[model samples]
Target chain A: MLAKRIIPCLDIKDGRTVKGVNFEGLRDAGDPVELARRYAKEGADELVFLDITATKEKRKTLVKLVEKIALELDIPFTVGGGIGSVEEIADLLHAGADKVSLNSAIVRNPDLINEASRQFGSQCIVAAVDAKSQGDQWEVFISGGSKNTGKNALKWIKEVEERGAGEILLTSMDRDGTKSGFDLELLSAVNDITSIPVIASGGAGTSQHCIDAIKKAKADAVLAASIFHFQEIEIHDLKEKLKNADIPVRETI
Target chain B: MIAIINYEAGNLASVSNALQRLTIPHTITNKESELDKADGIIFPGVGHATPAMASLRENGLDSWLKQTTKPVLGICLGMQLFYESSEEGDSEGLGVIPGRLKKFDSSQHKVPHMGWNTFSDVNAHPLVKGFGTEEYFYYVHSYYAPENEFTTASCHYINEFSSVVCRDNYMGVQFHPEKSGKEGSLLLQNFIQIVSSE
Candidate 1:
């Protein structure tokens, strides 16, 4: 059986993790390498690094940092943010990123997804969708969730999947960072439509919230940031809880 | 030393990255001579079989690999290329292993078996030695090589597919051990151990 995945997302800036991750035993908590090592050790099914670096030179630093993370962590690591071109995506993959996520860039040129998937295999391309609820349906947002594309979220998912996206990273903008819980209604709506795996992101506060996202919402994977960055929920304990709940997760200990 | 074959199939960094952590000296090369320098070869691929096989042939790696007696481990598309042929694009394999690649029935199961999945029916080969009997390895693929005489381990996703296939001088895995967490690292360590013994 395929184990439900628990992923920790970390934002990178200036070649360092944006969130002040301070897990004990980690010599450098803010360092992406150390934090990634801890997450892998604690049984994170996967890790996603959103390179929020702004400067052109710092982007090079992010690439170097990606190679370092690859050397340090053995789990699947995904790099996203500011990846707009095939050349850039190739650089990250060559730097040892298992997969690359595309958001605004994918929308800007949907052909990019087709071309990338053709070059790197659909398995390595992740289509991340940032969406917000509007009336009954959801609207897709781009530019770091600041602008609504007006394209229906559910409709976009079908397009990306058909366009050869292997997986969908669905984030609920309204629920992001709320700590209330994942938008189950939004997640379920996406899950119900797509055959490809759906990763539910945003609004993860409690460990139980993750469990519910899986059992109730039928998410193939759950991705959270603050909950993991602040150590609000230790990955090891969370995995234990998920295991006890019969969710079939990897054993960290 | 291990030579990670470079045929422009995709990135060779992940394979090299895992070897670096294991303290295993390795190099990424496409030259036919560089392959003989290493005790073992790790063939990694990430694209369609048609173009991948094309690159291998262009570099004469197809013939070199078919003739090499040293341990050659194939990953993902690399593994599919070890068999006689793949249904994907009607591509020809290295013919190192006698099996046919089959695409997962999307009607019954997901086309690409993505995420962490457990391996079962593991054979007592050095490749799987000292590893936990039950473990999950990261995998993402729409096609898989079915079990045959070279079958070492099997994993169930949509159905029972050959997870690990091994024959004389060649072993292949459908999953990315480099990205499979602790268990994957252990598997790579075991591969290194296999190379050292040879």
Candidate 2:
């Protein structure tokens, strides 16, 4: 049986990790590579680096940061944000990223996901969907969860999966930065339809919240930002709680 | 020097990075002459069986690999390719080991048998040096080679499959040591030491 994964998501800007309130009002966390190395030592199943900066300088910095992290850490890591082409993914993989995630690019040209997966294996490609409830349906949002794509979240997920995406990272824009709990409804909706491993992101307040998301949402993995970044909950203790709750976790040394 | 056979599969970087972290000299090459010059060869691959085998044949690496007297370590698809045949594409393997790879019966468990699985040590082998009798290793595969005479370690997904198999100079593991964390790196280090000693 596959152990449930615990992931720490780092929001990067200009090669530094920053966390914001509601995806704005950013505060510097630390150097991205240093933070990544710490997380890997703390037994984080994986690390996700999302470059929030859209500038060319920051993008170049991100590539070097990824190289630094790849050199230091042995665990799997993913790099996302402003990635637009297969060549960019190839470059990132060459630099050290285990998987490359697509957001806005996939919304603009859905074929990129399929073509990438066809060229690279599906396992190397991750489709990230930002969803928010619009009336009765959850709509997909792009550009760091600021703009709505006007596409149905569930439908888009199915399309991407059909296009050969190996996994789906579902983040709830409404629940993001709230730290209340995961968007269980959103998770349930996507989990009900897709067989691909779903990574539940955003709104993880307490260790119990992580447990609820995995057990109720049926997520293969849970990703959190604020709680972990602020040291509100230590990753090892959280994994211990989850392990006691019968959730399979990688043992911490 | 260690040679990682490149057959258009993923995870080569992870393997090379592991070797570099340990300060072990290695070269990534698909060419026959470079592989022949290496003291040991690490055949690392990830993907379906058919195309992987085809790529090996297309590059003329399959035959060249068989002629080498150096120790060879195959990971994941590289391990399956050591078998006689695979059910993945109903394709033939290198036949280095006398066994057939078959898909796990999903009715008993899930397909793609992803994540950490424990291997019951059947015999002591240099490649698995520091590993305990029941050590867990990361695995991600749908088809597995059934238990056979050469099997050195066994793991159960739906039923027992050959987790590690050893023969004269050939050894293969059905797990990704490059991605399996500390214990995994230790195993790779052990393999490196074994090759160095040889």
Candidate 3:
């Protein structure tokens, strides 16, 4: 049986791990390499490092950090943020990242998804869709959720799958950092429309929220930041709760 | 030393990094001469079988892999390439193992079968010495080799599939041990032990 994955997303800026509440106020968490090692030890199924700095000048530091993290971390990890070209994606993968997540770059040039997937294989290309509720529908937001693309979230998800993205990291801008819970309705809607694996992100306050994301929305994985970063919820204890809820989670001991 | 076969298969770095962390001596090489100097070979791959096979043949690794007497372990697409053929691009394999690879029925289950899944029926083999049914390994693939005579261990998703396949001198795992955490590291360590024993 495929266990439901529990991921700890480390938002990286200036090579340090930081968590933003609603993508605005940045709070220092800890060192990325140290946190990554701790999370792996705590039984995180996978790790995602989003380089929030994502500047052309900062690309070198991100690559170096990725190489360092890959040296210490054993589980599969993803590196994203300002990954525009196939060359950048190649550099990250070559640096030992198991996968690379693309956001604004892919939205601007959707063909990059096709070309990157074709060149690196879809297994390594992840399409991260950040969305927020507008009226009755969810609209895609890019550039760290600062700009709304006005694209229907559901339709864009289907397009991304068709473009050969192996996985979709669907984050709810409305739920991110709120710690209330994941946007279940949005997640389920995206889940229904796409066949590729959907990773539910944002609004993870408690273990029940994680369970709801998995059981209610049918998310293959759940990614949270502050909860794990602050020790508010220990991954092992959360997996215990998830296991008690009959959700298949990897062993955490 | 373990020589990781580098046929332009996308994931040589992670495998080499894993071995380096384990403090195991290894090298990534496409040359037959380098492979000849190693005691074991790790064939790491992640991509479509067609292009992977094309690269293998282009580098003349298909014949070398077929004739190599040293212990060989293939990961993911590398394992799929050990079979007779794959439905993915209708590509032919090295034929070290019988049968062909089939795509999972997406109508019934997820296409890629990603994430941690446990394997059962783990026959007593050196490569899987301490692995049990409860252990989980990281997997990400669309095509799977069905359970067959060469299957040493199997996993179930939509259907029972060969997760670990082995025969004399050759072993293949559909999961990425290099990225499977502690248990994954243990599997690599076990492989090195097997190489040492041989």
Candidate 4:
């Protein structure tokens, strides 16, 4: 059986871990490699390092950080943020990242998804979609949830899968950083339309929220930041709760 | 030293990085001379089957892989390539194992069978000496080699398939041991022990 994955998404800026509320008001978290090692020790199935840095030497710093984390962390990790070209994707994979997530890059040039998946294999390409609820439907937001792309979230999800994206990292902009719970309706809607694995992101406040995402929405994985980062919820205990709920998860060996 | 056969299949950095953490010396090479010099061969790959076989033949590693008696460990697509053929590209394999790779029926189950899955119905072998059915390994592939005479352990997704297979000196695992965390590292250590014993 394929266990439901629990992921800790780390927002990296200038080579350090940071977290922002609703994609603004960033604050220092901790050292990325150190935090990553701790998460792996506590049983995080995978880790996502979203580079929120905005420097000219950003890629260089991210590559260095990825190499450092890969050297220390045993589990798989992904690098994303401002990854525009196939060459940049190649550089990150060469630096030891097991996969790379694309957001604005793919939205700007949708062909990049096809090209990258064709070149590096779809299993390594993740399409991260930040969706915000409008009056009746959800709209796709890019540039870290600041700009709305005027694209329907469901349609974009279909397009990415058709374009060969192996996975979908779906974030709810409406519920991000609120810590209430995951947007189950949105998650279920996306899961209903796509065959590829959908990773539920944003609005993760408690272990119940994680369970709801998996049990209710049928998410293949759940990703949270502040809850795991601040020690509010230990991954070990969360896995126990998930198991108690009859959700299959990988035990920390 | 372990030589990771490099036929431009995919990234070899994670494999070499894992070995480095284990303090095992390895080299990524496409040359037959370098592979012949190594104590063990680590065959790693990712991507489609047709082009992969083409690249292997282009570099003449196919014949070398078919004949080499040295302990060889194949991971993911590398393992799939050890069979007689695969439905992925309608291409032929190295014919080292008596089976063909088949794509998971997506109508009933999700394609790619991604994430942590465990193997059970184990047969005692050095590569899986300590591994149990409770132990899980990272997997990300669409095609799989069904359970056969060469299967050492089996995992259930859409159906029972050879998650780990061994024949003589050649061993292949459908999971990425390097990316599977503690169990992954332990599996790699087991392979290191096999190579060291040789």
Candidate 5:
């Protein structure tokens, strides 16, 4: 059986990890390399580096940062934000990212997913879906959740899979950064429709919430940024709590 | 020194960086001469088997990989290429290891077995000796090679399948030790030690 994954997302800006992560042993969180090493030390199953604002000039710096982090950390890491073409995705993969997540670009050109999966592999492509609840349904949002695409969430989920996406990173815009809890209803509905692995994102406040994301939402993985960034929850402690809750997690030293 | 065969498949950086972290001298090469000089070979790959095999054939690595006798380790798609053939791209493998690759039935479990999974029915080998029998390692692949006489370790996902396989001088593992964490680092350390000893 595959163990559930607990991922800590690092929001990067101009080649630096924003929202500092401080502890006794770890260095400054401003350095992505140091933060990556620290997260690996704390037994993080995987890490996601999202370049919050990826500009044309800052792309090289971000790639260099990714290479540095990859050199020191042994765990699998993903790179997202401003991933537009297959050529760019190939370049990042060679630079040391195990996978690349696509958002707005994929929404505009769905064939990019198929082309990339053929050029690289489905396992290397992660389709990030940012959705907000609207009445009885959930609407898909893009452009870093700033613009509503006016597309149905469930329909888009199936389209990505059929277009050759390996995994879906479902983020709830309404609950993001709130730390209230995961959107269980949305996650469950998405998981029910698609057979692919769904990573539940948004609103992870406590360790119990992570458990609920797995047990209740049936998410294969739970991804959080703010909770992990503020040092409210340590990866090791969270893994321990999840293990005790009957959820099989990777054994961290 | 270990040589990571670069046949145009992605993920070579991760494998090379893992070796560097262990302080083991290694090179990422597609040249037959460099591969010939290296003590051990690590065939790293991702993506489909057809294009991967084509890349190997284009660079003349297909024949070279089959003829080499030094200890060689294959990861993910690399492991799949060791078999007689794979159903992923309907391409023929190196025939170095005696087996055929099969795709997992999504009806049984998830298509790609992504994330960490533990080992069962592990045999004593230098590469896996330092780790526990049940220690979990990260895996990300859709097609898998079935168990046979060369299977060194087995793991259960949708069904019981061979996760680690070794045939004489060639060894293969479905999981990516480079991405597996502390236990994974130890496993790579063990591989380096095995190569250095040889």
Candidate 6:
């Protein structure tokens, strides 16, 4: 059986990693490459480098940073934020990113997903969706959970999968930084609708939270920030807990 | 110099970068003349099988690659292309390894077997030198070649599929050693050391 992945996401800004509460009020974590190497050694399944700085200056910095990380780290990594075109994705991939994640760009132009999957292969394109619950529905949010798209979460996921998005990274804005756990209902809703691998993000505060997301939400992978970045929980320990829960994990050295 | 046969496949950068990290000198080219100067060849590809084989034939790399006696390694699609044929486009392969690549029946498991999977104990080979039997390597492929006499390592995806195959100077891995973290880099390092010693 395929192992459930435990991923630590580093929100990079201007070549430095920044972590905030609920995606706001950023604080410095450490050098992106150094932090990535540490996590890789600590038994993280993968690393996600999200370039929170949307400016052109920061984008170039992120590309260079990714190159640096690739040189040092031996684990799989993903680069996202401000990736708008095929050429940009190509640049990131060429810089040593295993996958290029599309969020805002895909919302503005869904066709980019099809074009990117065609040019780069669907396995490398991950569609990241930020969702917040509104009454009885989970609505898709864009621009790092700042704007509502008025689109149904499940509907958009199916559309993106049809558009050739290889995987879906669903983050719950409501649960993010709450330290409560994942939004199980929202995760289940999206997981029920798509066949592509789903990476559950946001609101992971403990090892049990990760286990719950996989067993209850039925997610293929789990991603966290504060828990990992703040060292509240080490990746190896969390993976051990998940292993005890019968969730498959890569054996640690 | 080592040659990485380039035909517009995914993860070329990672492969080249891995080689660079190990400080191994290499070149990426499709030109036959440059390929001939190389002591070893690495055929790396990530895409559908039919067109990948077509691209090789279109570029006339098929004939050029067949004549190479130097150590040759194929990763993912590169491995599939070494087979006699593939069900992807019902396309014929390089026939360097005697087998047929077929699609994984989704009914049994899943298609496009992705992520990391473990490799069984490997016989004493230069490529498997530093790596252990239980070491996991990254893999992403829709079609896989059935295990045959050439299989050097096996991985069970629904059922056992050929993970690594070796015959004479030729080698093939359905998994992507370039992208597969430490174990993967060590494998590449072993390949470089083998080539350098030769």
What are the models' TM-scores? 0.97, 0.91, 0.97, 0.97, 0.97, 0.92
Q: After superposition, how far is residue A155 of candidate 1 from its true place, in Å?
A: 0.6
Which candidate number maximizes TM-score? Answer: 5
How good is the docking of model 6, as DockQ?
0.52
**Tens digits of per-residue lDDT for model 6 on A27-86?**
323677767777888888788989888666876787788888887877788899879999
Give lDDT tens digits, candidate 5, residues A1-253.
6899989899999988887566566656588888877778888889999998656777788778888888998889899997899888987888999999999999999999999988889998999999999888899898888889889999999999999999999998888989999999999999988878888999999999899989988999999987777789988899999989999888777
**lDDT, residue B18, candidate 2:** 84
DockQ computed for model 2 against the true two-chain complex using alpha carbons:
0.45
How would you encode candidate 3's per-residue C-alpha lDDT over A1-253 as one tens digit per residue?
7999999998889898776333212232357887788789889999999888856678899989999998888999999988899989988998989999999999999999999888889888999999999998999999999999999999999999999999999999999989999999999898888888999998999999999999999999999988887778989999999999999889958
**lDDT tens digits by residue: candidate 1, A1-253:** 8888899999988988886766778888788888888788778889999988888796689789988888888888899998999999888888888899999999999999999999889988999999999988899999998898999999999999999999999999989989999999999888888888899998999989999999999999999998888899988898888889899887757
Model 4 TM-score on chain A: 0.95
Pairs clashing in candidate 1?
Answer: none
Off by over 4 Å in 5: none
Model 3 clashes, total count = 0
Q: What are the per-residue Cα lDDT tens digits for candidate 2 across A1-253? A: 4578899999888887786423222232367777776777788888899888877686678778888888777888899999999988888887878888999999999999988887676767889999999999999999887898899999999999889887899999889889889999999889888867789998999999899999998888899988877778889999999999999788756
In model 4, which regions exceed 4 Å deviation?
A20-29
For residue A252, give model 1's deviation from the true position in Å: 2.4
lDDT of 5 by residue, B1-198 (tens): 889998867489999999888888899899999999999999988989998898999989999999988989998899889999888767899999877788988886667899999987788888778665568899998898888888889998888888899887788889999998877888877777788788
Q: Candidate 1 docking category?
A: medium
Scoring only the second chain, what is candidate 3's TM-score?
Answer: 0.98
Candidate DockQ values, in order, are: 0.76, 0.45, 0.86, 0.78, 0.86, 0.52
Please identify which of the two predictions, 4 or 5, would achieve the higher DockQ against the true structure: 5
